[model samples]
Target: MDANDLRDLGWTSEGPDYRGSRFHVRYVAHIATHRQGGVANLVTDECRDTRYAERMLQEWARDALKHSGLSQAELARRLTAHLHRAIDRAAVNKMTLGKRAIAGDEMIAIEEITGFPAPLENADGLIKVPMLDSLVSAGNLSPREPVKPEDVDRYVAASGLPPGDWIALSVEGDSMDLVSPPGSVIFINRADTRLVEGGFYVVAIEGDHGTTYKRYRASPEHFAPYSTNRDHGPVIIDDAFRVVGRVYRTMLDIGPHASRRGK
Candidate 1:
């Protein structure tokens, strides 16, 4: 349910339709932040009870339904039933537990009423997908963008290669220079080369755990992590090294510093 997963779900923030006027389950929590008073006040309380937030949202949904053209009595009955269901879903006991509250059923009821489902919930239910976070979120790279996905097969065929999963990470150190500098964004492809030879890549290793952005060299037995910096020596890879992925894109944004140097 991180930023990347949201992007992949076709949830764009740029459209007027996506503005606060629309009510999605996940968006409910976000939009609640800007509510005129009551809900916003509850959500903003540093030590506010979770049940309070749930109750406030349930009330808010009831109001929305009334505006949806339902009669007063019908709205009252429907909202009451939904609130009871939400209380059970949220696991709220008779006694208010304050800090231990979970969003529970009320949130789901809100979604059901609004007709927008949460991606994380769907991932757990029908999709059975993995928890995700990576480059597609940071705008570093994408599998398909201006080109529609149905047209991807044609694009891949024209390029003579299969489409790959892309990821991006910030370069932290100077080990990779000349090609990539500190703070550069590097895009990687895990499917590109499973077992890589000599090439720039993002290597994920355990034990001495780290994700290194470097030029990886594979030999008959052992491997080496080479650095473009002349002063830095190659990191010898033993059985301990594991390759997570490889670097496929690099963006250097030194801003005024790069300009000040006139490069």
Candidate 2:
């Protein structure tokens, strides 16, 4: 795929400070474990001196596998069972880069196996420096101070998403405590709106400050947004209401610092 052609397929550049830096998104095939080699390969950058690559790989695997319907326990079981057949980081890394270098008919065979074309032309990922202070614009979080999107990025990165693909936000209340705790750092995908019911999401609604987070409850009459803390109650649906996006992932105990990338 041509780099310029990627935009047609929803690919774009991303970086830690989308507001301040210039970053490019590189697209690739989403891989899963294979019996031939059980590890899903996703990146090709030479490991070199970057010990952090392992952590990045682990996190990406979690997100990719989870999205593929493999539970954490199930993933562990599979890895343990396929340890011998499992592809280690070195081999997987090579595979990712090789996949990125292929061309023509070869790309088709690779795509069939990975569900993504080889020499992947353009980026399929997106990144933006989310406004941290808006972490809890919801009524519940109204009392807290804002955090930085870059700091949230690091926290979310440790949670297993590419830094360019994650955004941090503060928890407004306990409405999502079954999963998200108050003040926890939330890593959200602005494009993921089809969140599973009963799952958590970050919503925005008309508020004194602007938009805020709410537990998403979809129904015929309205997109019922709720709060975990009973004191907050549920905000019913209306014609003007909309779901900004779903909370596919999140993190906690993020260190107090801004993301330092590019410079």
Candidate 3:
């Protein structure tokens, strides 16, 4: 399915980050199926490699045709009749053999014709990032410390993240706005805690003001919000404040899906 179809099915795109531009359609579909106590019919591996997708498409097409008991000619005739597209036997052979790139519409047509799942349903190369129990505030700094690994209760399949100690934190408010809205999942590189330059970071203050997400600049130690919401002001990082982790990537929460925890 295309992005529009995924969105219609309550899936949202978490755009390109360190991994490249891959949609989280399989992940969302898994969540939807899980919530309904149904098995996810699509492949949900977090693979981003193009060659893998191509191979998967070819395999799925062959399997679909074999299971449907329809010969290439019959399938092509049916596709042309139902989709009003000139998909002949040769075109079907090329797609099933992985010679031609399958367009989104054609894939949809194939799924409709063969009663098969979407070919690109599996996530192949994504690593599951742990979601920490601790919450980071996007509105006001809350008094919470980063938790240990034992405190982690969930995992999120993500790509494009730099290799390092990483953890996922949920944004609690809209203080960061466009960059990270409320309920967004932010990935932090735990090993890169030392301040270097101006970028987003999760910081903890000594006193009542706890962890917060903000644009942090090192030359002049201070943290500020990118949001136009003036309720929050810039905070000067002093001896009492500590850098928790650098925010490298984020996944937007599109609906009521719980983070998948490690079993």
Candidate 4:
């Protein structure tokens, strides 16, 4: 099971709570035993082996340096002054290059200095989801297809989403308006394809009509618009309509000209 699965079962990184309100002795024991086993399993898991971990460390260190906009010598000096840890440029290079393993204290110091998680701890609370190349229309129908890995623009890390299959889609129109404006990115939980009352969803119709985003309601099925201008009226849902996925979250693009017309 993954970290999320363990969390669902009440396992915490703060360690087992034998005396806590929700705690059972057996549950605590199980957590301890399983956590150890899980660590071992993760170490052996594909893409998380020793080599990958070293590469991840190197990449994170380099990324941290780049993001900090500080030279190695300057960072080393700052680390020594602020953290009160006498780590020199040579030591930083050696650690970043994977020539030396970063100690726990050093990791903590680096995290404090850079305001970024250490490589070994980076994946603790993040889920990586693919950003699809195809745009989902907010006003008109757009062609939809199964997303391949090669078609992914990038992998985006998200948190607090329900555990399920998810895909990212770029908004193409202002139909979703304030909720998901054009140029915004929406995260859809593909597993939640069932029609639900009073929820925004990506939907498709039969034939070559393609897909569009709409606020859906069941019982008297229809695709309702939330736009103020009301350019499009409510579309009556029929047997031809298919609920593709639910829009769980939206990342708005608040660029300089985002408020302008046809943006």
| TM-score of every candidate relative to the true structure | 0.34, 0.37, 0.47, 0.51
How do the residues 1-263 of candidate 4 rate in per-residue lDDT, one tens digit apiece?
A: 44566668876667554444555646645775675766534534755565776778778888788877778898789777644347799988987798986654455556657777665444444465677766433213223555565667654556678887788787766777768777777898777877778898888765544577789867577887667557867777654866668899988646454443124
Q: Which candidate would rank higher by lDDT, 2 or 3?
A: 3
Candidate 3 residue spans exceeding 4 A from truth: 1-124, 136-150, 256-263
Go through the candidates in order and give each one's C-alpha lDDT: 0.45, 0.41, 0.67, 0.68
lDDT of 1 at 91: 35
lDDT of 4 at 158: 65
Tens digits of lDDT, candidate 1, 205-251: 44443545667655643334344667776566653554545666676
- Sorted on TM-score, best first, the list reads 4, 3, 2, 1
TM-score (C-alpha, index-matched) for candidate 3: 0.47
lDDT of 2 by residue, 1-263 (tens): 44444445554544122332332342223212221233334233334323344344334443444354644454434433332133334433343333322122222322332333222222122232343445443222322224333333222122235433335566655655656566566666555656465656565555442355655555533233343556655566543444455666655443333221111
| Candidate 4, number of clashes | 0
Scored by lDDT, model 2 comes in at 0.41
Query: What's the CA error at residue 177 for candidate 2, in Å?
Result: 3.0
By summed lDDT, which 10 consecutive residues of candidate 2 come out lowest? 254-263
What shift in Å separates residue 134 of candidate 1 from its native position after superposition?
Answer: 10
* Root-mean-square deviation of every model: 22.3, 21.0, 22.2, 13.7
* Global local distance difference test of model 3: 0.67
lDDT of 4 at 258: 43
